[model samples]
Target: MKTASIAHRVVDFLRRWPPFQYFDDDELFSLVSAGRVVFHERDELVFMQGRQRKPYVYVIQQGAVRLEEQSEDGVDQLRDVRGEGDLLGIGRYLGFGEHVYTARTETDVILYALPAEAFWETVKRHARASRFLATYFSVAILPPALEMREERSEELRLGRRPVDWMSRPVEQPSRPLTCLPDTAARDVARLLAERDAAAAVVIDGQGAPRGVVTPRTLSDEVASGRQPPDTPAQALMRPVCAVAAPGLEAGDYLTRMLDQQTEHLVLTANGRLDGPFAGVITRRDLTRVEGAAPLALIEDMARAPRISELAALRVQAEGVLAAGLTDPDATRWLAPMAGAFNAAVLRRVVMLVEGALADQGLASPNLDHCWVFFGSAARNELFTRHDLDCGLIYDDPDPGHARGARAYFLELGRRVSAALAACGFVTSAKAISAGHPSACRSVGEWEVAFADWIHQPIESCVYRATSRFDLRPVHGDCRLVERLERHIHGEEDRNPRFVPLLLEDSMANLPPLTFFRGLVVDDEGGYREVLDLLRATLQPVVDIARALALDSGRQAPTTLDRLLVLQPEDDESSLLIEETAAAFRNALYHRARTGLTTGTDGSRVDPAKLTRLEQNLLKSGFRTVLRLMEYTGRRYGLTPRR
Candidate 1:
């Protein structure tokens, strides 16, 4: 064939798929000219598992290929089937030198093999084309990407040379000197000197961090004779510079300090400044880590000057999470750390939204308000596939001002929500976000809303409460959230019908188990015959923990923490609690591992992928979920509704 004719045929095929479709005609033709056609017979091996990869990527022009993995018993199990337009040899393109899965032609096939170098050159030249390919790669070829990552994790775990910028285990430094906001500055200084600390955290009555007093502030206030030593610490301290959460690496604190240009960062138990104070990280801690920190991405997101920069920083945050998945302890920390990063992103989005609203000549909301997060984000159990479930709660607006104030907050919600989506948070399908008017309400409105839901106790109301009751303040004035929390706990305590309805709702989804079939799979959903680990396993535990915690007048955010705080009524219950806790941990570990490996929320598991021990542990976990449901039923004098 003539060179031009051959290139024309290749371009014709390339234009039919994404990424190439994003390229201009001239770019497409140029991209195709560097490629050549290759042919494979039916059943011929295109690439072998464990073989070093070639420096070329293949796009099928005709026919199909099967990706398979060989088991220890020497049996080939089909992993995926790819047809025309599907890219192959991506393992090599992604820098995984050895093919993890063997690709074999399912029929006589024609493929265009493009050199990796040329493809990357094109990707570099076309920004939109690169984005198109990235979206395609994340959605379609993520499994292989995950496999490559897991291989790197294994290398690290085996004590191979460490990746640059090693993450040191997060430590809880000795408790910093603390005082009430009303404490005299002289007393604060004495305590700081007595504790041998450079700063003191000034907290409110509830132990929520309000501000910080550093040596410089002390010197400026007292030593300069600008104010009497009797001045309250609240008047002298600066707003808390930044808050670090547990499990954050030393590098994370360092990055926060560098980004804020502050010498000190407070450590909070759950990453919320309003949560319990744990410790502090100072400038001295930065010396422990020798390279650029991944947490720098979060800092970058916070300081991002534009929406585009914020969006790009989020991608970097995801990369950080992906890299951290290799370390087991780091993996444990990934969800919470991701939550902290997300909170910072959301705050930036809010600031931008407020600024945009101001530019539009819209008046700011005329009430104190808060941004509340629900579901996994609220519980600090966020993972890759989680979406935004948030709402707005403002102080009661004057009746005459209600309409305008509501409209302003609603628009703010919509703008911030859209920004969050751009930053990689999936929008909730249920419309249970700040963007929804029903979810954006005043504090009094929320109180009345909870009361109405409790009094009604309808199925839908209970269902909504199951998620809503897990709310936590993510940004804005958190006092509104504290008020909302007080209202929920009070309603739970006063209403006799609320706990039973909640119990019934929690028990509605029973864990799957059948003696003959073993672990039951969801047959009706997209995950047909695959175990719905999130629904059947983790959620039941989560639901039961929420119910029990509420019943005990406690509001622990996470399932594990809630389970730990429960006071079992009997030895049997205690044993179940301990066993159930262990099982829950196992299930969580498995989900995290699977999600990290597959680049999705690890909510589903194929039994075949689990070893015998893991399978047994999962079975036990489900059984414990079932038992907890029954216990709730009996404790509440409730019967399963037909």
Candidate 2:
């Protein structure tokens, strides 16, 4: 009778906490039945650091526990403290195999020890419980030690309700309309029509998706006389992309769709091309997920009939940015989505300008071209409005037609640049813009210019040309952008001096830390004593990644992606790389959050306004920046110029 009473008390306490609150009565009772209550006196050690992980995780039934880690010099450092219903060991041993810190009682304490395996099993079976835990423990899964304070500003919470829903795993994927690779196009079309689906997946003999056929494919193939209705499904199909069904979240799926520029994504057992086909996520399915407002806004921007409408939509994007930063899971995917919003606006602006030009009897020059964005825009790292840094690249024209082609492109560039400026992305005189004659060029000219910059390796050329290396095509012939990429790589391969010089250049901007290793702020101008977030912290990481990427032949456009691509295998080196990536992400988030609050470019920040925790994070990040810069210098056998 006493044992039963103790179990009942433990179950009542567990029920009050989340994850447990999500469990039903039977599951809750079962979980509590297998758990035991333990007590410790003040200062008693609960678990020792570096010991094998225990099979159980503890819930604080009473009192408190503090987690401590011994530094290399044998000093104990407090990592965290847990009290009341707080859970312990979730982050430290998610898969770590050993306790990362020592847990000691802060007072006489009572803990309900739950079996880890049984708890995880319950979490997996209950989606809400799983998601709650996923968000609560995301720090382990993502870059660590970035504990930013949650924003409580009214502006940030405006659209917070919808994001809660968006973060859920995509509603169970719809049963995909499927066809064999050898199935006839007519049969595929019939399947799509009969199901009222817009697309059909072509599967292999093992049920893996090989291709997809959409209404567009049918129209372009059979209806346009390019092929008969009896043509094989494979012949009418396009290469398909699949995401694993397990652990798939709606917001993540939407981001994948935006990134891949696909209207549909096939679901598979393992999220690989060869994995067994499961189902599909289409545009309509995304619309059903309320968290897809950002995507819907982008689509609306694309079809917006006028620049005024696009400008209005641009204003709404700020709300999206604010809401994303306020949410934990959405924050991880914020950069890509912001970039999508920016690109969508730019594409819309270009289309509007082109249409206006046509009305004025100014048809674009008959040449293949691409409008490319530089720096953050190219890297898809944009969070808010930035000064437009762009250039135009087109196919080489006939000798006599060169001047005409350049003139036409320049006119288009000027108008588009002006349109973007009106739409909130102003063009700074110091930054590169497509309207500038030097940046508006044909393919051959662009090739020659890039080669000169590479072979020259002069400070002036490198300084002016750094942005060019980060270029990504936002519109037009992507092949032109690829040709430029190949040209740049080929030049680097031939000119070994180029990457080294670039590395040295990257090191020129020392981390903005004082002699005492504190954040350095501007001493003069309207923004005196304010830290330039971009220059002091963000740019060093960007520069290091760019130089390292070029040297390693990594062509990924973003700093984070570049870092991942070039990450070393050595444990020590890997930790430094990981820290550097985390620093960059933290700084970027801080800058964006600051920008949203201050209504500036997010470049300058007043450290005094930051929470103590945020200030500490910045200091830690700056230190990591210093370490990364030193690592880069050592790698290149060069020193930062005094």
Candidate 3:
């Protein structure tokens, strides 16, 4: 009877917080039954950083605990303060082998010691509980109230539709079709037919994957008479693309395939090329996953023949974006997939334009070139249609045909831009476009232009030239783009004053926040009480990322990608950087969601329309932006003006 009373008290405490709040009564009671109450005095250490794994985790019944870690200077730096109902030693529950930070009581505290083994066992049956823990642990630091509200929002959104299968763990094939490297091509084909498999994995004697064989191989090689029917499978095999099966979701599989530009992924015991093969995931397999809206759109855009048809398909991309915004878990992968759809449309646009030019009897000045995107499109973060910023770069011509080559490309660039405009990607007002003769230039000319911007450091010229640094080649020869990047970096190395001037230029637009940390709203625009999300918040973050990328010589194109490469000078700076990344994501999501719902460009958002939780989050995000500005000022030795 006494034991039952203790269990009841424990259950009451555990059910008040996540991830335990996500669990049902039976699961909660089971977890609480294995826990016992413990006490700690003020200033007593609960756990030490880098210590071996503990058998149990703690939940605070009352009082607070301070989490800190030793710095390089051998001083303890506080990271977080966990209050009542907060979970401690979460690393053990998450499979972390050692403590990452030392936890010490700030006041006399009562903790419920929950056995890690029992907790794990209880959570395994509760999928929602497990997911909550996963997401909660992934972030740096968030207030408990905000975290709980966000999870509740996620629950409501996720319940409105079927879960995205792409985010689920990919299943290992029970019987993957395999063949020896020495097997005949015809025999490999026959085996695939017998098993009704899409492709066959070529394996060596030790059961390690070597490569893959598809029907396309037969149609291109054996049937085309390039190779005989008796040719060895190894001779016709493409390099094997393999990934580990354990802990990898289907979205992860898709990302790897996109990175390697391959169609097939072989699942193995480990994520090594030489590891034992487990199964295969093909493009065809991905097509079958429900909620593959983005993948389907990309495929449709590739097959679209006319500018009008491509425009219609682009509208479907908005639908995909709308569905993704509602589900927070899926939004993380949405940007890249949406970018892929846009890239396909652009590639088709180029093809159609070239064909049209050929029909007009315009002939033969085929110089190697690359078509690149600038601004948000280049960063792979475009969720809504915005003004297009693009440029064209071609190889230099010989002295004799320079004039003709220039004329041919100029005409081609204008047609490409016109086609894109027809397809709803209207050119930017700044006129930094492929259609303009200034933006269409030879590789040598582009180098000279970039060099001028670096050495001269004029504010207006640098402002006009900033988009070029975010260059991402979507079509044509990539070598030209490579040459340009190398030249830009080399020029920065030579001109020491260039980067600081660039930093100053980036800091030109201050974060829109008042002295009391309130948002600065538009007073002159048609949308009263509305905040311009892009100008007020997102652009400042983008500017900082671009300047840092140029200064560090890191070629990564996206804001998040740039942050990944940056190493903060101190622990405080590191925490701020992490928080800044999170804030940027939240702000971007709000903008995208607003645009899709209101049919506007998504640059402006009315704060009064936001939920109470969103308003709070936005305020928190503004504080983060403010802190970031101070950090930047200190790092660059420049005062940031409000």
Candidate 4:
């Protein structure tokens, strides 16, 4: 009788929430039948700063709750508030250890809770409703309300109208600067110093740029202390590297400067540099505004309330990154910037889960643990759609708070994954999310799992190993992941024999090329080029690097970094791998830039629009992918499967 009454109250509470709002009387009744209700008095703590907790998410019914965060300096500050219709206690259900923040009731509070097992089973049967509910939570449950309404507006706009964030902004110093060829060196230097600038365009009688006198020239000339200060600037001026443009995106302009490592860029109103310097872009300019919209959003996301917001911003940033790939320098700078965004999102996810767990009274105040991202997500080497591969680890073998800690992480994964999906990641068909029981194992359990994968060495294991090797830990008590590194290196160091096997696996997936000399897309015929590019080329680099790193017991953080660290510099094989990776990245940008410009899918490209030179660039890219595969294949004495 008591259980029935509790369930009734729970259903009544759920009826007020959006994702669950449409539930009919019977459906609501069915859902709360498996729920538990709890009561809290004023100033009562439902969860503490650290305690392991059971599996159940909570809903606020009659009173309000406050979520607060414990900072690095040991200060606690209120981060969020929850009241009627709000989903509460999700942290407890997610099961990440050590709450990111603590929670307290502002007044007498009545909450309805549903066990994790019950929630999962029910959500599985109600996939559509669950998705809706997940989306609802992602939108509604951010911490401190995270000032994310602006970014959210972007998402809404994106839903109804495609908005280009990478497009050049309206406000810029587009006015041309001019100087005379006969101007004295001291006079030109005067203009340069007055503007706090580096260069000026020396104009002729026709108002055309005749020669350029830049800070480089002035600095060198003045430092020599030989030429007269009043010497004509024409004697020191040199031809400038100018771009003929029909206007360019800021991304385009930035790419040019970074590629040449030059400070100044000259723009022409027409399509050639000789006409005149319409405007200039200095490294200072890029440095000042480098917090581009996506990066700004990423910075915003570091303090963002929920993973959903982070995910959305991350996807948008990925788009921005893709657009910048139109030039090589942009591609290189964008990679680490992408990593920054990825790391920020990941760090915030951990913080949020930590807060939630603490608020729920599930975290163990003293137990040590760390969280980490795995696979591409870990490396921040993610795509627009990818799985939320993450894990947790523990230091103490028999930490008494094991069960509650594990439970917290499981819940964290559940909520975060749901949020991640709402943000933009494609749903994993295999259900390999950290929320899954098998994937959300403790660090020791992870060791066992990794060991099994390594020792088995079968088809399934090979596939899993490739994914595992790419794993990077982004957040949490990072020692957990460090332990993972030690474990991998320790095992490899002992055996040294698996290196060949891994290299062989690297070559297993051959480069994609049709027998008829056209691109070989997949059986589905969707973005076959992307698949070929990644599998045939990119994966091989990732694989060969992992194998070589393992063989030498070296910890190379990135694929590029791994290539850079190889023993014999300038070796053909190493050079081939590095060059191929670069080419593949360039090809990816080619596709990305074209897509951004034409509103096409970013994954595929129509080769026809490319100029002959562009087409050649792409072919060079594909060949590089092939070459990368071949180099890895040769390294291990294996032939590609294809």
Candidate 5:
């Protein structure tokens, strides 16, 4: 074929794939014009494993190539198959320097050979193209952590910091609302209402902030008839837990608010209790400057009066997650915000359900009872498609009221589950919800159940125990959950067999990857070719992190946080942990983006549609997950199932 005809054909083929699809006509023509075509017969060796790579990368114009690994027995194992539009010999182009797998022609092949340096230079000139290339290369050959660090360093050098978008001074209004300790509670409430303020700060004689009085305090005291209208403000005030010095970055103060779970913070000159109070920075002020602030959404969730209101806020919260997907650091804030919203909604449902029960003359359960969330909800890593996985842990009632209490709580659970469903949460399919009889157990019953699961280690029980192990108190008495956590830790320590069983259970689902180190897609039923990002990518990391954290006696709920707190035994272990953490973050970013764009939970990823960067990150993440699984098996002395 003539030179122009061959170049035109190559350009046509390259345009069908991305980031080439993003290239304009002139760019496409130029890219292909600099490339040359080569033909290989069936069974021909394109590249040999362990040999230095050629200076050019190949793009298949026609036919197929097989990537193979030489086994210890000298037999070749099929790793991956590449066809039209697939880029071959990418390992060396990605700086691997040598081929890990030998590539041979599966059929007579027509390939376009592009100069590696020229192709890289072209990719670097386009931002999207560079990102796609970088992503692909990182997954195929580089460690995700190294890629992330390099990308972040480049961003910093270019003066594009994620914090820059959130950093601003907290706006302070002149003559902020203030009250004296001796002020009547009714008067303080009236003043707050008149000023349209969520809270008011109480100052001492020296103008140092003593406490903050919020609507919650007024509702708990005056409106509930626990205190009279003449009660002093000091009696209704809560000590301010978060205080910051003036002139500090607003982002710093916002971090404090999120950490403390407070809506208001007092600003003092020296950030000391005795220092003169400067002003107050309400959650509202911080949110005004940085919309989608997690602390602000949490405050909004808490104050929502109706289920409908919470449902609306849930959509907004998802929008925040969508925005956060572009920046990996934002994932840290996303989970906590989603958790707070889930907790608020659950609390509201419980309250409504209790009121309905009272109207029907059913007595309330003991105040010592707690509502415990399990699985993703407990980890505070909720996605929009997540189901309700929770149960009730109550103090045993008096002998005469025992039967009645059980009946009452079961009814309450059913009502609460229905209420949550009405607000968009689905009931747990595994019957893990509070409405299930087995889940609505007394504290002693729960202890017995845990002991049974620990001692038995049966398959069915192990599956149930996986969710139960990640317990968190979403509402009611938190002490119950605290006690349960201690019991779980103590049981694990005492039972030598528990850790191995847990490790075995965690290794049940390995990350889906084919022999050629390519992603395995769902070929089952309706979801053909779809990647189960949640199960194949996220779950393995979550399970491994959970087992390690539990074994180390670390109590962090979320997977990423647990991984962060774990003290790896050596430098190699530490590197593995770090790489796995980075991979986890990247997976979260991909899932969030997919969920946002598709209006679903972001659990399913279509590998074909993923950008080069996303694919690379995912591949690197899967690799890390596999390594972690192998480490677990070796550490526990468990043999592979083959």
Candidate 6:
């Protein structure tokens, strides 16, 4: 059978649609030919309820296909409609028995009928296509994305959420075994054996968690044989470090643990640690949150009505992520959450902004404009910061062609920028706003400008590349966005001038801390009276990771995730690299929390507020980040250019 010009258009349209977007042109045409086109009169049954549909899928070509449902509860409802190129009979092709919804032609219609064997054969060969059909077949599967979400929710309710990857308070520690500060090692050792326990909590006179003495700790001390066997248990005990309110997420658990610098967390009913130790949360608990975070957020995004609601919801999703950044396992959990939410938000932004722009005369003749997100968003790195880096690409650069489109793009950016601002992040002050001429350009102009940036590799050019690496289409033609990326990779993937210079810029991260001595802060110095958020942590890790990734042709959107993909396995160095990054995130979270608590933007951590154990952990983690930054600089030969 010969495919029509209309069939080719169907192919083109299907290729643009998702799941189908994953298929190539040749394969698409074959799919069109295997499918038969039929016309239906008004109010006729396209496929009856309980009908056995074996060899066809339908796409509403010229009119609409309405699916009416007769519920078991004795109510009739219009389930959904398939209009225009919307694919239908997916359940018929994919479902096993009787159809759940009855399909009827709403108006005079031309519908394409795809052969079941051919469609299934094509889908079976492609996993995304299989999932694509499976996903859209019903509203149910689309909600949580998987069964794992309910399990995660249950875990969160049980206080075993993502933060627990850093720690899990004992499900039930046997009846309290406490020892006085002055208890002997011999007595403590004997008591441990008698109680059939490896450790015992050491409390002050007031019965507060002062420290803990474990067999490993005790044995290590005993190995020295310096202290008498009768030495006080407190003498060998590690001081209490991180403490949190009971029933927190695993991510929070890991973060607080990382911040306080201890694996053992003292849990309290309230924030105050005056009560008995509720339990301990070890780093083993973060794993559950990873599988759960992405699913939970996706479900929540589906339920959320307004963008404002989603903004807060997105913020809530970060609770575990903040914690995951502390423990080694936490980042793993954070990665998928970051990627999924980032993708979800980008998708929703396109829908919302497109609707808003349509109201403002965008696409008056089916718009040729594309709204793109660059920098972190494009590359799948979504931080809480307002990274308002975006651009608009239209089909023509002949100023007159985009006059209405330009105004639409400006209004589009303003609305999106405002939406993002209301959602927590502060927008950019400079004209990176889509309304600005510098950011919004016609497709030809954008291409020319991009080419110039790639070739020049100047200071301004460096900034552009650094900021624009993550350019993704939030709205309009994503093919246009992909083309832009291909052009970038082809031109600047390993450009010596650009890569080397990026390395140099990244090298100017936090100053290496003294190994023997600690970092010093001068009275009026940048680090003075505050934890240098930029220098004390995140900047060094992010900047160096980005540089290393770019230099190595990894071409990632962000620092941490790129590093993970680049070196998925853990060795001495990669472990150090990962842990160092976690430390940076830990510091940032701590600063943010501190700032939030004190109602001050300055992330001031009072050394006195932290227990000795926490101070030590913070010091060790901070030092690790500093060392990693220096190591990357040395490894990459990032010498200061004269």
Clashing pairs in 5: 79-516, 80-516, 135-613, 136-612
lDDT of 4 at 252: 57
Instruction: State how far residue 265 of model 1 sits from its true place (Å).
Output: 5.1
Model 1 sits at a Cα RMSD from the real structure of 15.4
List the lowest-lDDT window of 10 residues for candidate 1: 147-156
Candidate 2 yields a Cα-based lDDT of 0.76
User: What is the number of backbone collisions in each predicted candidate, taken in the order shown?
Assistant: 0, 1, 0, 32, 4, 26
Best by TM-score: 5
Show the lowest summed lDDT stretch of 10 residues, model 5.
Answer: 152-161
Query: On lDDT, who's better, 2 or 3?
Result: 2
lDDT of each: 0.70, 0.76, 0.73, 0.58, 0.73, 0.58
- Scored by lDDT, model 4 comes in at 0.58
Which portions of model 2 miss their true places by more than 4 Å? Answer: 1-174, 180-198, 202-251, 260-263, 267-278, 283-290, 327-331, 514-528
What is candidate 2's TM-score against the reference? 0.69
Query: Could you tell me which 10 consecutive residues in candidate 2 have the lowest summed lDDT?
Result: 516-525
Cα TM-score per model:
0.60, 0.69, 0.70, 0.50, 0.81, 0.47
Residues 458-529, candidate 5: write the lDDT tens digits: 844776668788888877787888888888889888987887777787777656542122335221111236
Model 3 sits at a Cα RMSD from the real structure of 10.8
Could you report the Cα RMSD, in angstroms, for every candidate shown? 15.4, 10.9, 10.8, 25.8, 5.7, 28.6
For candidate 3, give the lDDT of residue 480.
Answer: 97
Q: Residue-wise lDDT of candidate 1 within 246-362, one digit each (tens)?
A: 777665665456445466788788888689887777654554554435446655766788888987877676666666554333433455656666676777888888988889888
lDDT of 4 by residue, 1-642 (tens): 687776766676676564366456775676677666789999998787776655666777788787766778997755455567665555533335555557889889987776656555554444333533343222123222122221221111112222233345423465455688778888888887877765687777765666668877887886578678887877888776555363566555554443333456765556465564566665555556443354345557776777667776776766666544535434445554555565566567667766877788765535466655565555445434445566556555456767766776677777666655666656556435767776677778777776666666673465664666656655556677788778877766665557777777676655433211123432122223233335544556667777777777777666666776777444665556556556656544553454345544344554434432343344445455556666666666777664
lDDT per residue as tens, model 3, 1-642: 699998987888777776687688887787778667899999999999999867887888888787787888988855556666666786765556899899999899999988887776666556555545544343455323222333336522412443366677766666889989999999998998898887888989888899889988977999999999999999998877446564577777776565344566887788788888888887777776654455556666777878999999988877766765664345567666656666777788888988888999999487899988877778877776666667789999998999998898888888888888788775447646787887899999899888888888684387777777788888889999999999999999999877777777666655443111123422111123567777666777888888888888877878988977898888887888887787788777777777667666677876656643355455456656666776887888876553
